[model samples]
Target: MELQQMRYVVAVAETNSFTRAAELCLVVQSALSQQIARLERELGARLFERTSRRVRLTPAGAAFLATARQCLQAADRAVAEVAAAVGEVRGRLAVGLISTVAAVDIPGALREFHQVHPSVRISLRGTASEELVEQVREGTIDVAFLGLPTTARPEGVHARELAHDRHVAVVAPDHPLAGERAVGLRRLAAETFVDLPAGTAGRMQTDQAFAAAGLDRDVAFEVTNADLLARMVREGLGAAMLPSAYVPQLTGVVTIEVTDAPARVEYVIWSRSGPTPAAAAFLALLGIPAS
Candidate 1:
């Protein structure tokens, strides 16, 4: 039936009480009852059964409720699409990103986005790659950027490789291996390593590379964020394996390429709800070759 009728039906179904539903719908109980009655009449079915103690949906009402929700959702989406088309783009865009993106590019990108689309609000939340993907699937974010396994692509989300980062080993400048041009995988077998926490994409990739090269190194410490990881490397807590770009020019720390490791690439992923103009514009500035 009509979108308004669907809204009324859903409100009644959720509250399970006409009086409370009407209050939530911001209308009088009598008016809401009239709309529900009209909807049932149009469908030629009895929608809800009422008794002294409580209200319950009839079998027909239960069936109609599912379709009613879909109708209401579609209508709301239509309104949002129309607004975006007119360049009025005046809604919130929620984004989920890995910690490094927020630390590396998000602040600058968001600054530029705000300058051009001041009307569109943004809420940014950062987490590990797996967590960010879950947020996107749950409809908590409009999009995400993270590094994850090429295997197990999530349904209904488009992922694109943005840039490749060579995972490097960071050692203090005065360390024994610092003078070497490149650190071979076998040489690092017995070295004390500092790395990101376990169960992260970075850790998994590191493990895979070490396994591939027949290398096994003892991890001396685990740090969570890029900045801190870099600092710990500088302090000589241990040599670390992390994204090359994240390595800082600490006085004591030097970056050495991993001779046998596969590079970790950053990926841009968006919910299939489709990209908004603001998100697209920011991506353009990043020089992402294609949408």
Candidate 2:
């Protein structure tokens, strides 16, 4: 019935352990358990099936979980709106981004945002661009930075274009194409490549470009991390096509311009419903006007 009890239920359900949820909620395990017990008694149903090995939500708990989260989000937004009205920005800011984000200096921007609004709590998640867009739409993430093909745009969210760049061929220093000032996709397609996993936005750009050019290439390795992809390229596992802006940060690899390279666009996206005050402040920092 109480907000705190609902919070306890939500925390326990998410963590799947009373002990871990207690740690996250900054409450003693006994206290959190006792509160949830009280809540269950009041609700006249058991919310969780607790076993020594694991905790699972009961049917009733599953039904309650979504509403509990919405209530909590609403409460937090109410408090944040009140603070905003008083010229204060205080709330949680959950930001998501892809690994190949070269358009924005994320850490530097976060540092500056924190310095200006020390009252806000900030968290960052790194994931594939499509997932970031979905998370933004779901409201789980307050804002996101994404890199997608120039032909694509994040759907169901408010997005602002940040930067546009083309992919460059990355090869080991001793590779045959390393010394080339520029190469066309037809030439590069014959070499083995290392790229992001199939179906990801990052991979789709290259895939679509090659498919359009009627060229078929082998991707010998699929990596999720940009740094790991660079390492793979450096060790001569395979060549990689990465954003030109990102290639400058890698060493032990040679970057060659691709005449028919796939173009990528960077964007900052937020919920279409409207940004929270914290998200609004961050967007303002990025020069995006409130909508």
Best by lDDT: 2
**Candidate 2's C-alpha lDDT?**
0.93
What is candidate 2's CA lDDT for residue 180?
Answer: 97
lDDT, each prediction: 0.74, 0.93
Name every residue pair that clashes in candidate 1.
none
The backbone clash count of each candidate, in order, is: 0, 0
TM-score of each: 0.67, 0.93
Cα error, residue 83 of model 2, in Å, equals: 1.3
Error of 2 at 109 (Å): 1.3
Q: In candidate 1, what are the lDDT values of residues 128-189, reduced to their tens digit? A: 88777766665557668887544434456777776666777788777887888798778877
Off by over 4 Å in 1: 1-79, 101-104, 149-156, 248-252, 284-291
231-257: candidate 2 lDDT, tens digit per residue = 999999999999999888899999999
